[model samples]
Target: MGEYNMMITEFPPGYRFMPTDVELIEHYLTKKVHCQLPFSSLSPLFQHIDANEFYNISPDNLVKNMCVDGGEQYFFIHGDKYFGGERGKSRVVGNGIGYWRCLGEEISIYNSEGDVIGLRVNLKYFSESSSKNNWTMQKYRLTCEYDTSDTEIEEWILGRITKGKRNDYSNYF
Candidate 1:
């Protein structure tokens, strides 16, 4: 028998990775963080979804290396925090030059069984001049017991970045 390499090099043409909020959190994000994804034979394609250093580079640069789907790029990033100005304040800002600010309160993600499975927060990036950039991000983290506290430690988070205007999810139901 001739030697052969059995591996999935790419997804089918025109295949999209668009997953709903719940699926992003409960399936991909959770599985990636827990190392439970059965991707031994598909690690190459699966590895592209990991954006561990998402905060280390500019959004524009990050986009260049991502597989964008419908103008939305999804990746798995480690949740890191720094103490912001003022006492006991911490922020999830990224990028060395610009800063990301929370656009609104974190939204709760519920499964079909009415259980809160995860949380999603929207963020907008602002330059040094305080001008809002076209880049926007939606970060989803798995739900835990300490979700009510701001000091809770998050391990892995799933992020969706869009270059243009933010998409409204009011009709996601």
Candidate 2:
């Protein structure tokens, strides 16, 4: 990876890497789902690997994406199913070490017309024991209103992952 990536680089390191609700919906997800931004442009911020592949990633590598929010950032390709018939995840994504646990309620991402663009899902990486906490991932996915197909869902994923020093649950609590 380059020294720094994305328009997000304009801000200083101490600045919060997290985006507000409006910024996520208006700037990132809308542009992403509506074809305003090219796939190449979005690729830098996210990687296509599944979360299970995450364990192979060195801790230092994951730590490199430090955000003011106190977490290192990461991105992974979210799949359609887990094991056999899970609703929105796969067992392999975090099979052994931990899992991407969804936090809070799913908020609707809407365009100016009030049409739902997608949903903002906040997930945390946790170890099997439940005592170990890893990272927090914020993902934006196109709503069924736009494309209900699994393939489309796979293609339109964009995630922001942060691994902070403290595993604070304030955002969810």
Candidate 3:
């Protein structure tokens, strides 16, 4: 059969697509990190650090409440949790600017009474990119505790869409 072509209209300048959280989780978070969205996006460091709601605590509160006293020099706080009849903190220490692997993951599911009900294995990344000042990654894995068991909830892997690929899609359309 002969080749067929299609035409696609482009949006005007200043117009953009806003992805829903579910869409972002499914497409961007699950697939890759370096994938470009329609608009200029913030760096991962800013995104992660700026999001206070995710951990149910603000940055100020984190620094005030969870900091390891004098451990702030060599380490950055990751999270603080009160669950599963246990309360603890998690952090990542400076190991130089390089790849840092996830040795393992722990998930604690708690009931309303703050008691452990379920636990399970959660997969983790073998390695991730880290700089002296920031954490950047091609791919990373996340685990979550659920009613049933721990779940491998998200993976951030990076893939590039090259100029040729863009041209191909434009021409194909």
Question: Which one wins on lDDT?
Answer: 1
The residue ranges of model 1 lying beyond 4 angstroms of the native Cα positions read 1-15, 38-52, 66-70, 82-96, 129-132, 145-154, 166-173
lDDT of each: 0.63, 0.54, 0.27
Model 3 error, position 150 (Å): 18
Q: In what order do the candidates fall by lDDT, top score first?
A: 1, 2, 3
lDDT of 2 at 157: 57
1-173: candidate 3 lDDT, tens digit per residue: 23355433555884433332233334444332223332223331123322123234322233343223221111111232211112222223233212223223434434456654333222111223421212211122223333433243222222111111111122332
lDDT, candidate 1, at 135: 79
Candidate 1: RMSD to truth? 7.0
Cα TM-score per model: 0.65, 0.54, 0.21
Candidate 1 structure quality by residue, lDDT tens digits, 60-133: 77778654433777665655442122222224335446666777667889999999998888876666644657
Alpha-carbon error at 88 in model 3, in Å? 14
Look at candidate 1 and tell me the lDDT of residue 117: 90
Residue-by-residue lDDT tens digits, candidate 2, 1-173: 67466455355654434455556656765564555656566454545555445544533345464545465443544453321212244232333544566665667877777887667766666565656465666666666564545343334455666666544444863
Question: Best TM-score goes to which candidate?
Answer: 1
Model 2 lowest lDDT segment of ten: 81-90
Error (Å) of candidate 3 at residue 119 is 18
